[model samples]
Target: MTEIINFRAGRYKISFHILHILMTEKYENNATQVPSSDDTLLGVINYQKVPTPIYDLTRILEGSSAQQQMSDLIDLLHEREKDHVEWLNALQSSIETGTEFTKARDPHQCAFGKWYDSFKSENEDLKHILQKFDEPHKVIHSLADKLLKMAATEGKEQALKVLNQQRKSTLRLLLNLFSAAREAVSSSYKPVIVYTTLNGATPSLGFLVDSVDDALTIDESDIQSFVNDQAIKFAGELNLPRMISGLITKDDVNSLLIDPSLIDASLPEAYENEASLA
Candidate 1:
């Protein structure tokens, strides 16, 4: 028998070997900023001032192509809204007789224009879709400020409790945002982030999940090799990059067992090779 950390992702009850789980931490704001190229690489988090890259495992499991499409859609929407605001401002200035408004190429090619075209075809309400972007950034910031004050005056334990509570609230708000975006685009997928270390390193990485369930032990007899499954093998080849080592069955549902070392493989070649030697 082997111990495992069970977590929920979509409708699946997934488990990782206990050895693979370094620790679990609350998701922080500094960790989730958008990255440059890789859609799965959400952003880096500071662990004791060491920057660590975070990966969206849910995106990887669902396949990168689909996630990329959704990410593009969201990006398009945000860009369109910004362009719309600028256009409206320009229109207002022209109406005030400041200057003549110059039309920028075809409006249909613009972000809002494209979104509007799709919205009309889909027959979804534009107001509701736009409203989904209203986030609680102010509330989150205020809570963060309060947390810092508590840390300075109340002490570590009390400040940690406050921080955890605030994190839960912030996570809930984030989930709402993600859920709203998915709903606006008619997608059913929902992703969450779990903080853990790769190969027992200092700075931890975040794994995108659907939801977290529980931690428990499993019988070793239930572990099965993934070598026979072509689909999983291919996923390992393309996305996870030698990450999936085996599968574990729990409640008749089989979940992939990931190797932490393979996650470390995502690092630069020099770092990965050094870590391997270490």
Candidate 2:
């Protein structure tokens, strides 16, 4: 028998757990980049004797449309594990007795050879001895399974950790250093770019304009009015979740706030009373 299920998303209400799955997946820059179909998948995982989708929220947020693609990624991970074991065992024996980079076939193999040589030169005899029985394939498979479990158990916390560890401020320094490089590419180009972040996630926008202009700030009350106008139009056209209260622009970034009244909303249901920012 088919059972009906429903969920909340912002102010919009949805029947499919698809919205919940997407919510678990983090979106980049208003859903601009699609996520790579890798990691453990939902849908095929059997729990309590029933098949359940084991979704990686990050991929969903990146706009992965097919569950089968995600399943394929999981299978690929297993295959890689098998290959990793063979490579590690091969590397260990070659390194213990002294492997030669000259005999390596590919760049990756050559790099590994160089690493082993460097390790041997540093008098790391223990590492050299340990390399022979490394059983790298087994480790890779174990790590993959652990990662899948972490994604399933921790959810948003794991997502936040992934975002925080990966987003680097060094990109900002590189951008400033290479400003001249942009002009050298095209003499007629006058480009302006906006660098912003969402919860420590790096986001960028480019604007090609003639010249710089003054910046302005608007009051929160006025912004709310603007959001209401856009929300009315968005709701009509998109058929987005009824739980979506409306699109709101806060702290220079726009987020679709979920309605407090909706039962299926993914946004936090609890709130704490705070006195002031100061």
- C-alpha RMSD of each candidate structure in angstroms: 18.3, 24.5
lDDT string, candidate 2, 1-278, tens digits: 11112222222222211122112222222222212232312223222332222322223233332234334433543443344434434433333333431233332343333443443211133334325423421232233333334445776356335423322332222233233322332232222222212222322111111112222232434133223333443211112244444444435544343332241232222210110110
Cα deviation in Å at residue 7, candidate 1? Answer: 1.6
Q: Which stretches of model 1 miss by more than 4 angstroms?
A: 32-36, 64-192, 198-201, 228-230, 233-238, 266-278
TM-score, cand. 2 vs. native: 0.22
Q: What's the lDDT for candidate 2?
A: 0.29
Give the C-alpha miss distance for residue 57 in model 2, angstroms: 12
- C-alpha lDDT (0 to 100) for residue 268 of candidate 2: 20
Model 1 poorest 10 in a row by lDDT: 229-238
